[model samples]
Target: MAARALKLKPPPARLWISEWPRGAINAARLAGARRRLREVPRGDGRPVLVLPGLFNSDRSNFALRGYLNRLGYRAFPWVLGRNLGARTIGVEGERLFARIAAVAAETGAPVTLIGVSLGGIMARLAAHRRPDLVREVITVSSPFAGDPRATNVWRAFEWLTGERIDDPRVAALREEIARPLPVPATAIWSASDGLVNGRACRIGGERAIEVVSSHVGVQLNPDVLVVIAKVLNGQNADHD
Candidate 1:
């Protein structure tokens, strides 16, 4: 049977935590409530372009970018627009591709892409298009096996994104992603991600990792950080 959502019916005592330390049980509600939510392949430290999940803008990724910056890597978010949808698989993709170029031109280094949710798919497509500029792809919750029908939220994706699941444009764009990007890639997902089925996040042709986190909590998850840190450094797996 497929995985089911791990619901948190009882409210947590706390609403927010700046961070979640590693090695702890993947707790959903704390004495205090909080949102909780990682890396490239290990030590390469190339410039990284981060793409936020659906409905998220650069503000959502500022913390992640800051963390990456502190680690001594240059990171950029999509300043061009909020992550609208993959339906723009054609026009918006062109815009996003241009943004990637702009970042590359400014940084003068190959970019390692870190994309979350819908942003994850966009990152993969961008990498596929410009392999030379894209060092590798690191995605969290981006679905590659098309998508799953279990979620009630993806209807929103279909709404905002101009492309329908069967739309010719959407299908055409997916064709490009059929072949995996030439560079190394890692897909991260959680047991509790209700937004997109965790299975959709799988990236073939290399090692993939599964972490324990909610659909919305991955951004604040510390275990996710440890794993993501490994990927950014170019390591496929980590005991850390």
Candidate 2:
């Protein structure tokens, strides 16, 4: 990585505080855009698993799952409870892989994964370990690439997961997950994100869609929903 990239920093403190109000506004935007959101092309009934961000529960992704279901895709939440990092999934993410495999087995087809924030990182790991069971991956506001510290939540992540971000083991896992995924992947990021640096969310070699939104709002943003719908339908979001 270049020296400049290595020096990447988290979003400013002001932006961090703005996330709350911005998230509320984005939610309102989503509500107002519902009619148009429903206009996105439908899917082919492929199963999609939606994973929530750190400290968030499946209930947080309820809106997203409902939207996907309305579009003809079978979307389910990561039912193992609120995301507690390694505590929720296994240290090696064995439990997450098991969930993905179960979904694939139930659907009789490789499953598509849509993960938000830390959930996205876990999704990529699962895809890396078992691409055979994963059809594709879509990440929203997830800092899978670049320094994980380039996010305001790094401290919270460390506190909750009970692991140092600078630990060599964590660094190794980040490098592994940051690599290009074996399955098709798309990254949805926001330059206005308050929780994580947008640059870190999108890797150079993968498909990326940019939206203007707060980090907490990306998963619920109507624009994000549209891009995700396009990707799942196999339509080009190259214009983004």
Best by TM-score: 2
lDDT for each candidate structure: 0.64, 0.88
Per-candidate Cα RMSD to the true structure, in Å, reads 7.4, 2.1
Model 1 ranges with Cα > 4 A deviation: 1-45, 86-92, 148-150, 236-240
Q: Which candidate tops lDDT?
A: 2
- Per-residue accuracy of model 1 over 26-103 as CA lDDT, tens digit each: 333321222222223224446788888777788877766776776667877778567777533356477778778888
The TM-score of predicted model 1 comes to 0.77
Which residue pairs collide in model 2, if any?
A: none
Task: Kindly list the per-residue Cα lDDT of model 2 for residues 100-187, writing each as its tens digit.
Answer: 8899899899999999999999999899899999999999999988787889888899998897888888877888888888899999
Model 2: per-residue Cα lDDT at residue 158:
91
- Prediction-by-prediction clash tally: 32, 0
TM-score of 2: 0.95
